[model samples]
Target: MTRQRKTDAPRAPESPGGWDVRSEELVAEAAVSGAETAAGSGAVSGTEAPAVSGAGAGSRPTRRGAGDPVKALMHRHRELCERAVDPLEIAAGLEAHGVTDRTAARFRHRDVFALAEEMYARVPRGEEERGASMAPPSRRSPDLPAGWALFALLPGVACGLTVVGLELGGGRARFAVGLGGLLAVSVALRVALRFGPLRSPHQAAPATRAWVCFLLAYALLGDELLRAAVAGGPDEPWAPSLTAALGLSLAVAPGVWCARLFAVAARKRLALSKGLTEFSASVRPLLLGVVALYLCALWALLLAAGAVQGEPAPAGAGALGALLLLSALLSSYGFTRAPLLTLGAAGAVEAGSVASVFAARLPGCDWIAVPVEEAVQAWGPGAVPVIACGAAAAALLLHAARVLSRASAHADETP
Candidate 1:
């Protein structure tokens, strides 16, 4: 004769809540069955066969005292029928499982369908906390207030501009005037913003505020120097002073901005990665190189200018050097990406250089004789060397442009 097997009965709800009661009953049954199985297995020897030979018979529902299967099923049907079901109520029920008040509030703000979907996602198919083991310990500092930043920036801008002005003016009356004017303007603007109804003080770092202010001042100075350089009138003693101011401004301004920008970008990226070693490794070298190159170029220009005239060659020389350095920096940026500002500045520099050369040459009418006479008048016996320097600078600029173009093309070819 064939042996018959028994199976565990399906759960029948016998409470006010249909699925809730069923789920609880199933959980209790599973726990009780697991305990019985453990006890039975322990009582037998390792090699002994189990006495029970039914399918899920030992795993039968635990709430047998409540009712028979048919009666329990009817109770479940009655409980479900008693409720006035709605989508929102359903979502709220599910969300009550493990969600926090804040999360529930956010869900409630959404439409019914969205709330339902969110609830469904939250309940089942939930993922374990992953990527947590990979994250590094955070080392974030509290953010400084906007007011603190504004205070710090005010002093830095003032000091930087004062130093630049003093250096440019060379202790002359004109330098004092220019420096005072710049300081007054800066102070007035800051004061107005601070005390006036439009009290929106800039929230940048001190260095950043200084650089921005200096850049503005330097731009004005650059225009003046450029005009002086191209003017047909006799060279004014103050022309060199104006040029120097412009040079100093350009030299420090962009570098300050770059440092600030890079620092902010790195901080954001690091936060996203939780200061992971791999991310730091990737960004460190590039940032270091940019800062090193910029500082080195600035120092080299200063040293070279000092050597040429034996006493710093006036502010004009420094200004010119700054222009050259700025051009190179801008060109590099343009080649690597798309710096429209840099490109425009380069075009202007090139155009200005060409225009100056033509203007100088046009008056002479004869290239050889004209240059000779102009050289004699401009620098006395020393004019020849100055002329040669100008020629060399022009040549160097042209060569740089060609190299930059090739490099850009190569970069474009890269995937």
Candidate 2:
């Protein structure tokens, strides 16, 4: 049997976190041999990470050579790395400590994620006593502000009273009230989401932001346009469907509630979890349950709104609402790209469904819209958004379950 070489672990630097070694040279000499092999001779093989005392907590590591700058950071945050469930958790902690991508670049890393990966990999994993693995409550950042969920009711109540006012008033006054109510409800929604778990951690690009707006506009106008197309061309000016608007408006409260529930439950489960596998096992079910709860609430709201309007439930608008909520939830947790892509795709389908109607008017091009025409004829225009956004919502829910279950995703989150 070949005898294996084992090096003693590098001692940590003496920082406020109680590190002991306080020298990057010690870490460089004691770091994994694989690092030297990868970096070659020019690396920080025996170099030191000079630390200036009293630089506060956010000091940068100044080291010579090119091997690995993460070694110094790893030691400084030794407690964090050893306790982290994975690299993502470490990344969150780093970001919370004011480490940004530009700061990460000083370490020759692409971003905080890359720097975190190196640090996580360099540190040796140690087993802790049962339940001791949970991060301190302060570091285990919760996202929902106190009493934020209560704010969700404002939008729904404002819109509901507006709908009632529309019924009581007549002629020009009713039109004016309807327009004013829409603006009021819009403001309430913005305020409600601003303080809740509904706010995304990462702001989406302008284009995807427009996609969400388009989905909302489509919710009001798509049904009327599709119905008109089905009835052989537009014979009158298009009007927004109050049911669709009301359904979308009412969805805000449930979405905020569901988001708050998910955030609280996930953080609780994270604290109780002993390992990554255990956290995933417990949190995934909680995510699905929250999603189901939201769907149930939304469906009931849509049904009631439809009943009030003396029409069938706008199932399509409900689907779009579900999609929007799921996307926002995912984005709030730093999983921005997935939700943006999914929402963009759903918007494309809705836009195409409407465009196909007009495009089909050309000779020899009717086949291009055959599927949409058939779907609209058989199930009405609601079928288009129902199919599109429903699929997107399901896809997002599945992705959310997988991504949000990670202990790292919730690390350093803020209320």
Candidate 3:
């Protein structure tokens, strides 16, 4: 990711004394909506919004008459409004909770921005901006420092050098070189996920991560090996696709960068917007632009792979790479559900196709492998991930549009 210029780096909004803006937001939402109170050491615990006590949410009485929706919202977010520096800050806060012009109409306001304006004016803040609130700085920097971009290259360079060593090494030396290459790739990937743009709060479980590992391993050996099985050739299945492995390894850099760009742009859009519809309008173009940039990067990398190897990559490798990059983006953004399932499904299909070709040698199951064998003869084994992962990536693109466009999707974002 390009380092955001210093001047463009987002400045933290000056907050009122007594409570952190984030803490206040959490407290207010809980007290008003969930009827729960937090007890803390500071003034934060004392300034909670009022709600029915010792009663279920169904039994709680409305705080305002049916005609005045503003009163209800104002009451619900009282703490947030009182702590806000400006109406725009309140507007951003509301929009983060899925509020919009349409919802605001019920409150008799022209838009969310207008509703926030009224709320800000109504709250009485005796001491608004004396200093930073009790909380430390918000964990919200979207920019990845240029140093990180440089660091992102470390893995690809190391992987490339190791691959060169593997190609040059012979006999017993090949094992050592391959082991070192795996180590280098692993450490570098950990760095990308640990601090750079690829990190997320909601890490997948180990069981889920098995699918990711399966996809990477399959990318390296699954295609060529499957073809050998289809032809009934005596080729070694363990003789991996070095170019495909390189493609997957080098992907870490651009994947981290694209995610960083998307996050920075999304945060900027969230702040400038007044309504959800306006924000969504802004998100669509940004999403497409980022995806286009990623595709270009992928194309360049694929070309580099072909040049280095002295042989062109399989046409289907492009589809596999796209699916892998999109899955990484989705995981980084906390939209893990679809990506995990897609990865698992794609890996399963590849493995199942291979199994079917072998299963045909069994008694009555000769026809079981016919479909796979014929398909391989018709389109090559690369068609498996090309079909499965290409479809998965398309489905994920749709999922990303629907969820990532929402401000709340990134509400819990960390630096």
Candidate 4:
């Protein structure tokens, strides 16, 4: 018999572009080699046959450079974030660039998701660095009284003048009291927000500074809108519309400023939540209380103005209603505990306000007949909507008070 020649097993076919060799081919070669080795030893071992099969079944052909795409995607995301690009905008850009859901799945490695999380995570340190670099050097010590304390008294001054004017001032004086007080308060708060927070105890907390900016913006936008409507004397029909439009246009600055502050606050909040930075719990309640009280007073004065005029509820009434709802909704996001409950209370008030608006607009509603004082009291049988709003407002104030008290207690406890 001719002697049989043994040869080495066949190798896997190499893929082009350095891609992984075919897994099935490698498995087949392994099985054949294992079988040959087993047969050569003696009788073919059963364990050897199953072992080869298991090896092939467990083996997977890894995609060539699977990590490269994920790394590139994460890098791009980080770049966009650093440049202050919105995540949604980044997502849109990715879609435009043909980075689809399937493309993401194609790179399905655990590291991919982890890397993506890291990519979007807030860089609080970077924010602090940017804020520090942009902030002008202290022209004076933040503690040096910048006359901002007087701005704190503006609300009380405006309120006292309003009460006195309502009780004794003539029609012209009442009008002046209403318009001038609103103007003074708005201007003072705007200036204070711009400069005050950057001074004194507030200077240390960038988040609080941002919070003040948001408050100033919100208050100014509403007040300016009201002023625009009222600036034109009641006799001048066309003037009110023009003035209103101008006011809205001018108010855009505060609106933009507020939006920017919100973004900053969100960044800071994310950093705080992630435990990447420290944030003061005590200062938040004080800031929130100041804003809540300011907004409440502004809403009250607007209501009072509408009452004094005996005219149809000014367009500003709607603004107050909107503010009420917004305040409720925003309270959840404010630096406080039990935000969900706060959200629900605000939502209830908002829903009630909507219902009232619809009810008031319905046929024969005769909202005009309701006296302004009674409406403000919101206590009569027909004043359910106003009552609900007032109650919500009261609850919000009380909650803020509770928060402030808690913060104060904590502060006293601390060194």
Worst 10 residues of 4 by lDDT: 406-415
Q: Which candidate is the best by lDDT?
A: 2
Q: Which regions of candidate 4 deviate over 4 angstroms?
A: 1-66, 81-152, 165-179, 189-272, 275-382, 385-415
Q: What value does the lDDT take at residue 326 in candidate 4?
A: 32
User: Against the hidden true structure, what lDDT does model 1 obtain?
Assistant: 0.37
TM-score attained by model 1: 0.23
* Model 4 lDDT, full chain set: 0.36
The TM-score values for the models, in the order shown, are 0.23, 0.73, 0.77, 0.31
Model 1, 65-169: lDDT tens per residue? 222221222233333223313223333232333322333333232332343333332222212322331332221222333453344234335544654555556
Total clashing residue pairs per candidate?
Answer: 1, 3, 0, 0
CA RMSD (A), model 1: 22.3
RMSD of each: 22.3, 11.0, 13.5, 17.4
lDDT of 4 by residue, 291-391 (tens): 55444544454555445444333343334333333342233234333333433453454344334433554588747324422443453222433343355
Off by over 4 Å in 2: 1-23, 29-73, 76-135, 138-146
Ordered by TM-score, highest first, the candidates read 3, 2, 4, 1
Best by TM-score: 3
Q: Lowest summed-lDDT stretch of 10 residues in model 3?
A: 36-45
Please state the error at residue 52 of candidate 4 in Å.
40
Model 4 clash tally, residue pairs: 0
